[model samples]
Target: MIACDNLTKRFGHFTAVDHVSFAVAKGSIFGFLGPNGSGKSTVIRMLCGLLSPSDGHARIAGFDVAREPAAIKPLIGYMSQKFSLYDELTAHENLNFYGRLYGLRGAALRRRYDELVGLTHLAPYLNRRAALLSGGWRQRLAMACSLIHQPSVLFLDEPTAGIDPVARRELWDLLFEFSSQGMTLFVTTHYMDEAERCSQVGYIHLSKLVVCGEPDDLKQLPVVNPPDTRRIDVTCEHVTVGLQAVRQLPGVRTATVFGQSMHLLVEASLSEDFIRTELARVNIPHADIRPIAPSLEDVFVALTNNRNGET
Candidate 1:
């Protein structure tokens, strides 16, 4: 439902999105991941018709984004990062306002309002002012307002940014529900776990798209799963100490502390016994070590480091 061919955006001498291109199949959830100021938002703005591309082009459902923005607008809904809402208006009033803004009125407006309220479970806070709602509730309200017109595609820019864990999970649940109903979703997120949930993902850095594919496929990329290398996880006390020790080992390519464990990339010849002995030297004995697969974060880290010519 979405396609971009060498989409480029420039501001004077600076390029924000450089020759970026990707496609999103209908009913699929495409996660766009990148660091701050990496041009993720710039691409979204260009695709949404809010900003004109300096070169190349993008299309939504076969309609040229730059030339037929009006036609595309009716086919897509956008929920920005800020949860755009009228602070003084109650949830119910806000919904009505957006519904009218989309040209819904009378019976039609009432029906969509009810559907959104039920979907977002905002009925309890219908009379509550937007400013009075909590972050989670405010996000739901924003999502409901975005869906007031029932567009086929939804663009969410970090939809779970400031909410609690429970709220984040709940928001994703709604996204899954939407995708199941054949609604295409384009989401930008900083969370690795959220990216894993997407049907396909694109990682952008330094205004360039580094990689784009399914999570498993990206993990299998040779850049990530290097030849003659094996990934392992070590669960032990003083993980930082274990990490430091393992980093100095000859065959250990990368060692990073993850929670109470350490994830390491090492040569296949680097046996677990060798790692255990190294940990023992640092008084971190009795470690539980096991082989593991590369995670989405690992894939991006490997690709980013490779791009920067780092070992």
Candidate 2:
């Protein structure tokens, strides 16, 4: 239940967000993807009433962000990239403080505190000071504090940044749990895997949203065809030589190394047999050769690099 129409934010002569518009349906996790300094956080702040937009307007749960900011504040919770908890306070104490700020007190505060502690698995460290907690623990505590008031809408700005893979996955699981309970999650993340997990994604580039749709829909956007510009992953001991050879081959448009493997953008006319025969002739020992689906990162790279020619 979130909507924005031509939302724009400017600072003097510079525009941070330019005419970005999108809607988040109830119970959906809408992922906002962008690189550093792409104005994602700026747009999020404007949507949450933390920053007034220089142009246009946003409505959250039916309340106008510009004219009725106070009305919307109580219905939403925001977790910023930075840890927003008292370093000296215990986990329980931090939750209590935020609960009080939201007007929760006595039994109500105690109940919410307990619920959040359990939900975020903070019981074991309830008496631990925030500064003493690990990064992952601190992140969980911050998320718990934000939800203590039980707001219907949650805005998470790079919530999983710098956390370990396991921790990030756990945090995503918690977000999906909240969505299943009818909470709307508007999240901005740098991780393509995380974006793929979202119900829908909005890609921001140069202060504007260049793409918005389901992850698969965005991945399927047509690109310039070398006819055979298919992606194939191959693992070989001689990755450097293999890449060079593949790039020089007819029907092969691009060959790049990804870790220990190689990703080839080849023509559709390049059959599996042809590829195998070429590798065999070169005496290259490949672990595997098969077509691989393009990831969100691949689509993003293609889209952002050559927008003029995209379909």
Candidate 3:
């Protein structure tokens, strides 16, 4: 249960979060996405009661963020992009420390630590120093420490950054497990795939919330792809060099590299044959060119481009 009522935050003359408003239902994962400096972390700080809002307000689990900052602190757990755990401390030691900070001790502390160890698959790394653990394992240790107090809500800012794909998936599994248990999770991520997994998503752009909705709803938004345009996926050689050349093609709306392939938003009237000819003209070799569904990235990109046009 989280609610924001026109929340705004400013620093000197610059506004970091601009009149943002959204509600996150209980037992759901709300993904926050934006480019760097888009105020994603700023909003999270205000919601967590770590940073005061310049105008308006937010309530975390019914507690007013500005009025009850202290009460809000114990009800939520926050993990940032970097590992907050001590590099010299072992996984178990980190958990024990945080547990003690939360006033947990004796049998209760031991039990909570044990539960986290198992839940995060940290039993094998219980004695491993945080510095020695891989990026993913270190993040897992940080997560276990954050949950030492069993907060009702969790705020993760770029939690999967710099971690491998497998590790990122594993982390999401744990987050989903938390959601199933009625824990409210607010996560900020750049990975479109991770955003797709969220029950709800809010896209922030230029310090404003541009769009917030279910993944499918956002994809289906008419603003994402114009009526006269459609996206095509192409697996081509020399992808790095082809991107520049492809963008210059007539009737090509936009072209961006997607993993090992390229996603081109082209005029709908342009046939696949025309696209092939254009690529051939530029000496860009490709094996396949086909239409695909709008992805989460597509929604955000369109929203961003539209926002730019409006301004």
Candidate 4:
């Protein structure tokens, strides 16, 4: 339902999105991942017809985003990062205002308002001013307003940013329900776990698309799983110290601290004894080492490093 062909965006001498291309199937949840200032939001703006692409084009549900913006506007809904809500307006008022903006009047507006309130469970806070609502409540209000018109596609830019874990999970549950009902979703997030849950994910770096595919397919990329090397997880005390020790080893390709453990990419010839002995020398005597698969994070880090080497 979404397609981009060499979509490029530039501002004077700086390029924000560079010839990026990808496609999102209908009812699919597509996760766009990247670091801050990686042009993730820029691409979303272009796709939503809020910004024009410098070269190439993007289409939504068969309508060109740039050329046929009017036709595409009613077909998509957008929930910005800031939860764009007026502080003085109550939640109920906000919904009614947006519904009217979408041209829903009288019976249709009332029906959509009721449905959104039920879907988001904003009944209790409907009469409360937007400024008084908590971050999670504000997010629900924003999403409800966006869906007031029942658009076929939804674009959410970091929809879970700053929200609590429970709220984040709840939001994803709602998204799943929407996707099940055949609404295409385009979401940008920095959370690796969230990216893993997507049907397809695209990683962007330095204004370029580094990779795009299913999470499992991305993990299988040769660049992520190098020849003659394997990944291992080390559960030990002082993970930072363990990471420093293993990263300096001759055959250890890379080591990154993950929570209370460390994940290391090392040559297949490097045995557990070798790693154990090294950690022992550094006062980390007890270490649990086990073979592990590359995670979505591992895929992105590997691809980003490769891209860095190329430039």
Among these predictions, the greatest lDDT belongs to 4
The pairs that clash in candidate 4 are none
Q: Whole-model Cα lDDT per candidate? A: 0.94, 0.87, 0.90, 0.95
> Candidate 2, residues 227-255: lDDT per residue as tens digits?
44788888877778777777778987667
Top TM-score prediction, candidate number: 4
The CA lDDT at 31 in model 2 is 96
Residue-wise lDDT of candidate 3 within 49-139, one digit each (tens)? 8799999989998999999988888889999879788988887788889999889989999888888888988888888888899999999
Each model's RMSD to truth, in Å?
1.2, 2.5, 1.7, 0.7
lDDT of 4 by residue, 1-311 (tens): 99999999999999999999999999999999999999999999999999999999999999999999999999999999999999999999999999999999999899989999999999999999999999999999999999999999999999999999999999999999999999999999989999999999999999999999999999999999999999999999988888888888999998888899988899999999999999999999899999999999999889988888888
Clashes by residue pair, model 3: none
Q: Between the candidate structures 2 and 4, which one is better when assessed by lDDT?
A: 4
Name the regions of candidate 4 deviating beyond 4 angstroms.
none
